[model samples]
Target: MNGFTRTVMRTVLQAIPTILGIIVISFLLLYLMPGDAVDAIAGMSGSASQETMDALRDTYGLNDSFIVQFFRYLGGVLTLNFGTSISYSAPVLDVIMERLPSTMILMLTAFVIALTVGIMVGWAMAVFAGKWPDRLLTSTSLLLYSAPNFWVGLMIIVIFSARLQWFPSGGAETIGAALTGWGWFLDRLKHLVLPSCALAAFFVAIYARLTRAAMLEVLRQDYIRTAAAKGLHPMLIQFRHGLRNALIPVTTVAGMHLGNMLGGAVVVETVFNWPGIGRLTMSAIAARDTQVLLGILLLTSVVVIIVNVIIDWLTTLLDPRIRS
Candidate 1:
């Protein structure tokens, strides 16, 4: 097989141990927590009899020894069976699947917005280095980077939703809108705008700063000087050579941010009341739904590992030096 193929295979193989470690650690930690699924359910019932609680513990195998329970869980995970949610009375995977699409839409939209805006702004800063434009961009990015996402979200909601009434304050759609076609599309987009902006705000700042730094570093390289001396058009040199090289670091950060967002924009999702995995995860934690919580953690770990692998592959593709 080719070197790249081998590299990819090796990376995938390496990730198995990491995944197993996550499972073991998360299982043990959760297992050692104060209460089990039975307590959570019995608490909700308010007056559940000891016999009822005992039956539940026995039925769900919560009464098993810790090692037996963990191994049983590990075996289920190996077969793609994430078990059932104690609170939801549904398979963990099924519950996650139902909410996954909304989260994906929000995260992908935010990622595109952050990447595009950050790159453009950062490139502008590089082009106007040491000038008023650069100073302004730098200051703005720092301010944004320092601000909390939830606060930004609330501020936007106040101005746009509460004051101007331009968009809904929260939710993925209108409660009972029967619209279709472009109308439905527009409605969804409107609902998405606020949350997307809030979620992307901090990431946009991070990308902008990283890209600007990368670009500045790249611009000082010997090859950049050679390209400039060769009489290539300045714009072409910047875009074709400088920007492409600068993107190496930017791409890595972008992949990490994408993975983080995929794991769920918990704060932003909670603030917006969006019915996504993040919100679901919060509910699971509050209810102590062990199966759902474990399922989310496993899914998140897998997503992060996959994203990192993709970033590594892309980096090698972008800079052949990495292949060696």
Candidate 2:
């Protein structure tokens, strides 16, 4: 009925083909890999009879023709009836959902910290361009961007966790802590500190650099000079005017990355043993659980579409010129 509704509908409709493309490509790639879930199961079991493997494939419909399997899987995806995961012997959807909350929490904490701190630091860099502060921040961001995330995570754990004993070494929570209420939330927060930092580090570098460039470019514009000529407070002029407009590029990159957020967390999740979707995805990959892998891919594409829609709405809200 309204413009935003219309935009959302149009976007969803347009995304249908994209989602289909992702599904087709991922399915073909995974299914075409050297082995299927049957082989993984057999290998893990030490060995299996030829007939046993055949029957297992048949049970999972893995012996179907490629076209048949593709359509069958696609149909289930469309209907939200994602097939069972071989590794877990459970519905793929249910299994992913079980681990989704932890990933979501980790992602939310990392994203918020990255965007907020990145923008603030970027603003500072722009304000102090060519100075010691700018050089320092730039060097720090470059360090974060260059370092391997898993390595960063390991170092953080060694110092803060293993040595200092400030937080648990790794995990979503204390095993059998039986915490609840604020205590429960606090414990979760403590566990989150290391992983979130590791996950956010790369993104923070990216956003900070992007924001710095965009802000610097924006501040050079005529309007910024005009605002300065009006004798506005330096901080207000730098942040309120320069930073807001500069957010376009930062927001664009952030939205583009929301889709891959879960995937990127795999390294951090693995390092921290966080029991999230990323860890589950790693297990699925190791086991070659095509059904679970496909389910995760499909969900990721859906998340991309949904996040883009939200980002579009927010962008238009932030910059009213886009609404027209």
Candidate 3:
């Protein structure tokens, strides 16, 4: 097989173990969590009879053996049929899909901003190694990295939203806002700014420090000296040679962060009251909506696996040493 094909095959093979592990682990954990759907709904609904609870249990297939119920859930997922949410009385997939777009937009925006700003800042710090710029970048990155995300989020809310009244305090858009044209697009962006900044703050710090450290290490190598001796334009030499080598580690960090961005959307989304998957998941959990929780967990596991596979492939491409 060719390089690309081999890499694809390897990724697929690796995914099998990951998928099976997640299925088994998630099933066991869910089963172990106290209270079945009937008990949960009964407690919440109140004044429920034993017969009604029994009927509800049968309807959810919770009456089946643990192993049987697990396989049934797994089968439904594989068939793209996640059954229905006990709490919402809607198809599980429908509930998840309804809130997916908002999360995806937030994560993608944060990832792009974090990477672009991070790499540039890191490169600048490396260029001015051991100087005032390097020290400043290092100190700032450490401080930001140590700061709490919720705290940062609230500060953004207080400063930008409350004090200046420059941005919306919460929600994806104004309650009755219409999604028609450029006006809606601009408004949506305006709402996205605070949450995106809160999410990207720590990431920017982490990536900047990581990239700077990697670049510093690469710059000490013989090839960097050789490139300098060749009299290549300083900009070209640093970008083409220094940055390329430095990217191997930075790429790994960025890719992992991308996967985390999807999961971590909950914090930013909740704080901003954005209608994203994280908020959806939180509601499902609060309502004891098993189907929605299971579906979301499975989907998130698959995404994280895909991200790692992509990272591995990129590693081989970036560093020929890993290709064979």
lDDT string for model 2 (245-272, tens) is: 9998888889888865676798889999
Ranking by TM-score: 2, 1, 3
Superposed model 1: Cα runs more than 4 Å off: 262-264
RMSD of each: 1.8, 1.3, 1.9
lDDT of 2 at 15: 95
The residue ranges of model 3 lying beyond 4 angstroms of the native Cα positions read 320-324
Q: Best by lDDT, which number? A: 2
Candidate 3 residue pairs in backbone clash: none
lDDT of each: 0.88, 0.89, 0.85
Predicted structure 2: clash tally: 0
The top-ranked prediction according to TM-score is: 2
Off by over 4 Å in 2: none
Q: Write the per-residue lDDT of candidate 3 for residues 72-178, one digit (tens) a residue.
A: 88888779998898888889888888887788788878877888888899999999999999999989888879987778899999999999999999998887866
How do the residues 1-324 of candidate 1 rate in per-residue lDDT, one tens digit apiece?
866687778888998998889899998888888887788787788878999989988998999999999999999998999999889899999999999788878988998889899999999999999999999999999988989888999999999999999999999989888889999999999999999999998888888988898999999999999999999999999999999899899988898777666543888999999999899988988787888988988887777777677788888888888888
Ranking by lDDT: 2, 1, 3
